[model samples]
Target: MDVLCESAPNDDDCGTRYSSSSSEDDERRDQGVAMTYMTLDSILNDNSRMFEFLRSFGVLANKYVCATCRKPMSCVKVATTRCGDGLMWRCAKDKVWRSVRKGTWFEKSKIKLKSIVLLTYCFCMRKSVQSTCRITGLSDKTVVDWFLSCREICSALMKKRGKIGGPGVVVEFGESSFGSNKYDKGRWMAEVWVWGAVVCGKDHGELVLNVVEKRDARTLQWFIEEHVENGTVIYSDKWDSYEDAEEFDLQSFAADHNYQFRNKVTGTMERYWKEVKRVLEGGKRRRSGLQSHLDEYIWRESVFVHGCAFHSFMQSVGALYVPRVED
Candidate 1:
C-alpha cells in the first residue's frame, strides 16, 4: 500500500486531473485500490485498509486516547461491524471501546470517510451538486451542506493568506452585479454587488473578492486599504468611486470602458472579472452564501495556478481541522 507523495506537479495535476488522470493515481492510493472521481467502489470491501489510509493522511488519528478511561487506545481488527469499519479502538485496563472515527473530522459525519474524501475531490473539481449527489449517493441537502462546509474551510484559510498586491505589483479593481430578474422583465428583483481586486501579470497572482453593500468612494477606498498593500500600481475604469485612489499611496490608472472595454493595460483584470462572474452566474446558490462561494473561487483560482489542487486542499484540511480526542 503506497501513499501518493507527488509534489509540485505541472499541467496534469491541476483540477480533477490529478486524481482522475491515470491508473497510477489509483495504484498510489493504496493496495490495488482504484479510486477515482466517479466511483470509489473498489475500496469499499476493505474497511481496515481504508481506515489506515485515512490515518496516513492525518484525516484520522494514528494514536488515540480513551476519554472515559484516560488510557491509550489500540487499533484492533474486529469480527463484527458497528462502527461501519471493522476496526475498533480498544483500551487495555477498563475495556473502554471507541469508534475509529471518534474525535476525528469524520466523527460526526454519518457518511463514510471514503465518501467524504470523494465529495471533497468533486467539490475541488467544481462538480455540480447533482453530479456529486449521483456520484456519492448523498442526498441533495447533504451535498449542499457539505459544499458550504468545504467553502467555510477555504474562507478560513483565505483570511490567513494576508493581503494581495504589494508595491510594484499591478492590481486591478472591478465590480459586477448578480441577482434574479423580476418577472422576466430584465429588472433585478434584488441587487448584489461583488467587488474584487486582482494582481495582474503573466504569472497568476493573488486576488481579493467580497460582497460589498455599496460601491461609493468610501467603500472602494476602504476595500483597497484593507485587502491590498500600500504603493500598489492599480488600474480600473474611470469611475467616481475611485477618484480618491491616489490619496492612499497607490498609483492608479483609469480606462474609459464606454469606448474601450479592456485596454492592454487592464486586460488581465477584465478577463478575471468575466471568469468569476461566469461561474457565479452558473450556480444557483442563495444570496446569503455568495460571500463564501467567492472565497472558494479566489482560493481555488490561486491554487489551481500552482497545480496539485486536490492534494493541496487535503493538506490544508489536515492543517486547519485538528481532531479532539479529549472531547
Candidate 2:
C-alpha cells in the first residue's frame, strides 16, 4: 500500500526516503506505512487501516499501564459482535480487561470509528447537515449528532484558551438580537440577545460569544468581566447599556452609529454580525441549539483565518480523549 508522509519543520529526512539496499528499502517502506493516512478513499475502503491510524493515538488501548499492579499493559484485538471489535488491554501482571473508550466521547457509542472521523471532516468543512448526510450516506440525525459533538468539543477548547484580550489588545464588543423581525405586525416574534467580543490580532486572534437574557448595563458589564481582560480598550457602538463600562473597570470606546464612525474595527464587527446573521438566515429563526450553532461559527472562523481548519479540527478531536497515565 502507498503511504503519504506529512512534512514537518525538520525536512532533512522527509517524504519516505529510500536506500539502495533491498533490506533498507523494505525498512523505509515500513516506516512510510507508519505515517498518518490522509486520503478519504484509503480510510473508508480499509477498516484495518482506519483502526491502525486511530491506534497510533492510543485510542484503542485501554491504558498505557496497569493501574492495580503498576505494570505496563499490552492491547490486542478481541472478537466481538459490535460494529467492530476494539482492543482489550491486559495488564502484563494483573490481566485485567480494561476499556479503551470507557470515559472518552466514543464510550458506549455503537457508531463506527471511521464514520465518526468522516463526520468530523465534513462538519469542519462547513458543509450543511443535509449535504453532509448525503455525502457520508449517514442518516440526518446521526450527522447532526456528530456535528454537535464536534461543536461541544471545540467549545471546550475555546474555554480552555481563556479570554482573548490582554493588555493593549484591541477588542471589538457588540450585542445583537437573533430571531424574527419584531416589526412584522401579523406574526409572533421571538428574539434572543447575543453578545460577542472579537479580539484583533494576527490570524483573527480569538472570539468569545454567549447568549444573554437582557441587553442592560449589568449584563454587559458581567460579560466584560467574564470574557475581557483588564486594560484592554473595548469598542462598541453608542448604546446606553455600555455607557457605564468605565465604572466597571473597563476601558471603553463608543462610535456613534448615527454619525457614521467608520472605524475599521467597528466595521469589522458589523461584518461579523452580518456573517452570523447570514448563517442563521431563514424565515423561521427560533432554531434549537442556537448557541451551539453560533459557537460552531466561532470555531470555524478562527480556524479558517489561520488557513488550517481541518488540521486544527482533527487536533481538537485528540484533545477530547486523554491517555491513561503510565505507572
Best by TM-score: 1
Estimate TM-scores for all models.
0.76, 0.70
Summarize candidate 1's per-residue lDDT along 1-327 as a digit string, tens digits.
211111322323122212224444632342222335433444434454556556656766767787777876766655455555656677767788777777776778887666787788778777789998998899999898888889998999988888876666777777777665452445444667778878877555688888888777668667866787765666777454445644532223222211111223466766776777788774334568888988988887777645456667766877776656654
In the order shown, the candidates' Cα RMSDs to the true structure are 9.2, 10.0
| Number of clashes recorded per candidate | 0, 0
Which residue pairs clash within candidate 1?
none
Give the alpha carbon lDDT tens digit for every residue of 112-224 in model 2: 66677677767666668898887778999999788878878777776776776766677887777777664355775587778898876545547777888877767866777
Please report, as a residue range, the 10-residue window in candidate 2 with the lowest summed lDDT.
253-262
CA lDDT scores, all candidates in order:
0.65, 0.59
Task: State the displacement of the C-alpha of residue 179, model 1, in Å, after optimal TM-score superposition.
Answer: 1.9
Error of 2 at 147 (Å): 1.6
lDDT of 2: 0.59
